[model samples]
Target chain A: MATATKMRFGIVIFPGSNCETDTWHALNDQMGAPVDYIWHGETDLSGYDCVILPGGFSYGDYLRTGAVARFSPVMGAVMEFADKGGLVLGICNGFQIMLEAGMLPGAMMRNVCQTLVCKYVHLRVETTDGPYTRAMSKGQVLRIPIAHGEGNYYADEAALADLKRNDQIVFRFSTAEGEITPEANPNGSLENIAGICNRERNVLGLMPHPERCSDPILGSADGRLVWESLLQAV
Target chain B: MAKARVTITLKKTIMDAQGQTVEKALHNLGYEGVGNLRIGKYIEMELNGAPATELPAQVDEMCRRLLANPIIEDFHVEIEE
Candidate 1:
């Protein structure tokens, strides 16, 4: 097994982002991966092997979720880091920021029910080739929680096809039995996509809170596979 | 100074769940002749200086870059005379 100390994680903190501490603790304490809180105003991320944009109502989700926070100074550094092939993970609101930053293709729209959904959902790992899913076998289902109002992932047909062709689709909402169904999809995301990665496979954006489930006490430590995968890959 | 009014709406193919919900509410309230209610954003901004001369293109840029997300929404800009 790869030692957790091998990977250094930086979780960005934007005003109105309430999940930074959770992410920090998950990485630093629970997973034992060296982690630090990188403020949104910071312009440097050279010290980290991976950058995480943790879930939260960044910039109060003003204008649009992540629309404002994408301009944060740290994002410039984060983008540079991603362009240079460093790993980047965006969870929930962080995923929104990634979409707004154009680091990932597509955008998230209001949930079909037009209400905030926060609960444990089953996600089937769609691809294991990416750094984030290396620990999980294909078709493996993990229990993770998604909390957000805007998680309806959408893209043009061309973009969607491209994502599929490149095997960039990382995970899909699924039933506990690993069956993908509309009833299992908490959000009306296109094709029930819960997560995806860039063509380079370095940047991943998903609408689930993996950090919340990294601890066994949380009732499900399935998310640990992702964190462990990060350490193993780096 | 010149002002630009921007109207942004989801693309035709995209599902507008909020608008659908609002439409259902209107139907329950017995509003007549409500057809295809699609909720959108209306923004008004003021501009000054040389930028005002290039208002249309500038507003287009704004819509493309920030005011609207081209993936799911389309934006129309109207400059005040």
Candidate 2:
């Protein structure tokens, strides 16, 4: 089995993406893994084991969050990469991009409170069957920070049912003790969904900034488990 | 030459926080009669040279492909030549 250090990570950088450096620092400096920055215009994603769409106001969050960036050329390649069962993770704005690109189901809406929410919150691991969550146990809670104005996740009833039936829900906002509650749901997301993977379990999108919390010096190391899980799976 | 107007708004089932906030502000400002007040986006663009017959479908494609997210919003298009 290839070790985590052997896996190469790629972070896609859109025009307004502000989290690529943080993501790079997490995966490269903190985790000691190989990493690269992929420009939004590039179409080749062949060499990376995992591709991340990091957080930020991509395309200035114009038209709508992630709407314009979805049309970027690299997204075509990202789709192709995921279609081949390659691992992909979208964080925050990246998660929004995934939804706009149709790489994941559902869409994000303005926060129910109509404000930009930025805080450290607890996310309960809803499942560990996928590559992104394999290193964590179901119901385990991790402290992660989320900063966004449109993280309220929504989907049609049929789609929600499909996700539930397929066990695609990977994380949900929860109390430190692992209790799922409306109070814990910072974005008013349906059922407090914080993260979900594709039916194939190779692609995951979440609103939290795991890369920001991957180091103990930064207050928590819980997010490192996500990277560790991918290492184990790939 | 042709001009197109695209209107996009959140689907009725989805909550429009910004719209509601604006509505409340209007009510506070003495416009209490304003009910069901929803906000939406209007985009105007000119197509250099497109047949009137084809403008609707082409603009509809634009709405579906980029102008609006079908999951949470609906769109209407008008074209004039």
Candidate 3:
């Protein structure tokens, strides 16, 4: 057996972002290389292979979900990173920001019934072949935390068709029997989508927080595979 | 010189769970007859630096990239000089 070298990951932090440290420790401290925090106001993105957008109420959620975050100074650097074929992951509010920035497909619309949802849920990996899920096998149920006011994912008909055809739909929420259940679908998302990857396979936007599930101390650490998945790529 | 006030709202088909929650809260607070409530966005920006010809495209890009989430929200920009 050989020791795999740790890789570099860049986590983006906006003024209201609250999950940067958690994500940093979950990936860097637990699985991969040390993580670096990229300020939202900074425009230059350099020396990092993976870009992460952490969750928080940006601009007090003044405009909409991620409406105010897409214009952050550091997003230009993130956009450039995506264009150059770099890995990018958006979690919770990060997922909203990605949709707003047009970095990934679809949007994180308001959840169905409009109540703040916070609980542990099961997420099935639809594709483990991608960089973000490579460490896990399909049909694996990960006990992860889901806390958000607006996390429903949506896309137009054509776009949804394309996403399905292109295999960009990465994760789907399911129940104990591995059946897609409307009850398990906490968010009012189409097709019970929990996460997705961009066409390039480098950009992954997921509503649930994998960082929150990286340690057993916090509870179920089924999300360790996600961090494990990224340990290989730089 | 002209600028626009862009207002974006979630599509009617989509459920505004936040608004509904707030509406319920309002009703619970003894406020009645409030038929509906929907939460959206309002943005006002003055673009004076760009040349007149490029302003529209710039605003369009701004709306497409940041101002609105095209999947479930629709936007309208009111221009004035």
Candidate 4:
């Protein structure tokens, strides 16, 4: 494993963000990484190398899942951090916030089934070129859990072209056999997209809860690969 | 005082999953021959003291910045004085 210098991870906690503790434990305890929870009201992001917006019903998913949370004070700093090429990862509701804040491209719509889906899913790593996927090999199938009512990813044709052209499409929903098929598309996301990175490759947003699947006893340790990859990338 | 009404809906190119689900339910309930049903959000806000002439632009910015996501949603702002 290529180990970069020790990096401190900061998890942003919105009013209703429920995954901070899980994310905190995953990084601090499981990975032996330094991590802390930062309030949404905080505007200073001077100390952290990587900032993660964990999943949850932020603001009770009011005015749309991540709409209100996009205006949080901490988001301003997060944006600044991102503009300066900081590594930003948004999982689940965090992905919604990233889209709402225009930090990432595209938007998330309600699942095609119109039901809250909570289950483990297989995702094929489309690219290992981003900060988060640096340690993951291309085409690696990872079993990660996703719990959300709105996870259908949508993007316009031009954006889709750009994503592919820039190699920003980092992961696609796939079967355990690594076949990208419609049946494996859990949320009806465009082209079964499960995750994507920004043009700069410093910001990544995805619907699955990678942190939740990082422990072997928890059923899958594939999620730890993302954290480990991020560690080395930073 | 002015009231701004924001109407937000999924872009035509995007599928409205919830709307389609509701459409199915409606069909099952015997509401046959129903046209396309699209679900969207209607937001009403009262602006205090902002100039009426500037309301449209301000409202547009609000839609672009918060009320709507341009990627998958289209929004229109109607002002009532």
Candidate 5:
């Protein structure tokens, strides 16, 4: 831990945010630190080092995941917070909302398989260098769980080229057939993109649930590095 | 009143996982005769452009600012008399 006083971290809890507690536990208890739970309606975001958009259907997945929730009062604060170069992490539905909110680029469409996916997925971290990835090395694969129906990411060629040129491509799906093509793209993400970081390199969003992987008792402990990164960043 | 039809879709290079899944669902439901199920959104709007002169730029700005993300989503607009 970075021995910083007042290590404030807030996780946005929306109406259907089912992973808030798990995220809270992973950050505060499992990781030996504490965080605050902020409602989606709260407008003030003062004195916080990290902010998280936890997983779950915000507004029951209406108007696309995170689309409606993005208009919430707190999101304005989030946008401001992100604009100032603070660390923000979005997972699963959080990731969906991040896309819809235009906090980052690309929108998540429905999954290619058309069914709700719920299982562990292999995510190859691409030289992780953000606040949430400080503890992990680049090209390391982490087995994390993913559960969502609209996890496919799409964008224009120019935008994708920007993501590539900027090295903003964070996580990708390793093809089952020993290739890493978009065809190997699980959930139909273009260019096999799984995770991404914003322009300032402060905001991070990933489809996999690192909070769920913090403890080995649940299934795997591959998520510990993500939490550890936060601890190390401060 | 002059109107326009707007179609929004993911770029060709970007994969449409949802459409593919729907296609698979159709096949699983015994509707196997279909192919290439690409999905996009259609929007209809009324415009105030006079003489049909500035309609193109106006609609383009509308889609560019709010309707589409320049990064991944593309849109087509058609003017209707």
Candidate 6:
């Protein structure tokens, strides 16, 4: 329990990253946890208990959403950290980078409407077994905002099956009452998946911007539970 | 010197929203023959002093590693000396 106070977080900042400050504010100011900014070129990550890949148009989203950013030097260190079971959370563009870096399974495509989808969305918690969701209960509905142009998640049939069997799915887009339907899916993601964890349950990638809604003044504090879960897990 | 051109497209199993939208626009313009339209990326690059024999494999590796994501995209490569 006392170890929770020592849990430090690192947020990676790529050139064009716009959400590092928001994430920093959520973890450090709002939550009173120690956090630092790590440049994309950084290669050492031994000092932090958790690493975050913040959202933004890294490399101007050229070629593909995260193709260029995946090769950043810090990613090697992030991968090493995750391989060793250290916690990592990727939000929006960060989620795309994780998919491009092969840290997460599946890929992101253009939104079904071919336009950026930016709005507060409802996500039904699928599982609370992982570090990121340990403080929540299954079937809990959370209001988080999602902003992205390419967030249509896709996975092959076989990989989808594996994710289902391993319980890697953590959150799914749903109605206010937690009904999973096509209308609830904003980006045409397969199974309306809004978030997922790695097989080890240490790395989490989600399209929603939890940091944006971490304070009640911002409209919702449901995102605070995600931070609390990490603190409690540590 | 060697030059490589790569074309990347969404996998057949994937729905291409951009392609569909463009197709609809073309139909509105009375180009109904433009059916089965699909949008893709074309990347051209030049390799300085690389042996022609190795260009194909090298470019293919690049496509596999960075240019195209196998989960949702397929890539084709062409090299010229």
- In Å, residue A109's CA in model 4 sits off its true spot by 0.6
DockQ of each: 0.85, 0.92, 0.61, 0.87, 0.42, 0.95
CA displacement after TM-score superposition, residue A44 of candidate 3 (Å): 3.2
Number of the top-ranking candidate, with DockQ as the measure: 6
lDDT of 1 at A76: 92
Compute the TM-score of each model's chain A versus the native chain A and list the values: 0.97, 0.98, 0.95, 0.97, 0.93, 0.98
Kindly report the docking quality category of candidate 5: acceptable
* lDDT of each residue in A17-36, candidate 4, tens digit only: 99999998788878888888
| Collision pairs in model 4 | none
Alpha-carbon runs more than 4 Å astray in model 1: A1-4
2 or 5: which has the higher lDDT?
A: 2
lDDT by residue (A137-226, candidate 3, tens digit) is: 888778788899888888888989999888898888888666888998988788989899898899899888999888788897777778
**Model 5, C-alpha of B70: deviation from truth (Å):** 6.5
Candidates, ranked, TM-score: 6, 2, 1, 4, 3, 5
TM-score of each: 0.97, 0.97, 0.85, 0.95, 0.79, 0.98
**What CAPRI grade goes to candidate 4?**
high
Better-scoring candidate (TM-score), 3 or 6: 6
Off by over 4 Å in 5: A1-6, A175-184, B1-81
lDDT of 4 at B50: 82
Tens-digit lDDT track for model 6 on A25-104?
A: 99988888999999999999998999999999999999899899999999999999999999999999999999999998
Residue B35 of model 4 has an lDDT of: 64
For candidate 1, the chain B TM-score comes to 0.92
Worst lDDT run of 10 residues, candidate 6 chain A, spans: A1-10
Question: What lDDT does candidate 5 reach at residue A81?
Answer: 94
* Candidates 2 and 3 compared by DockQ, better number: 2
Query: For residue B34, what is the lDDT in candidate 6?
Result: 92
* Deviation (Å) of A89 in candidate 5: 0.5
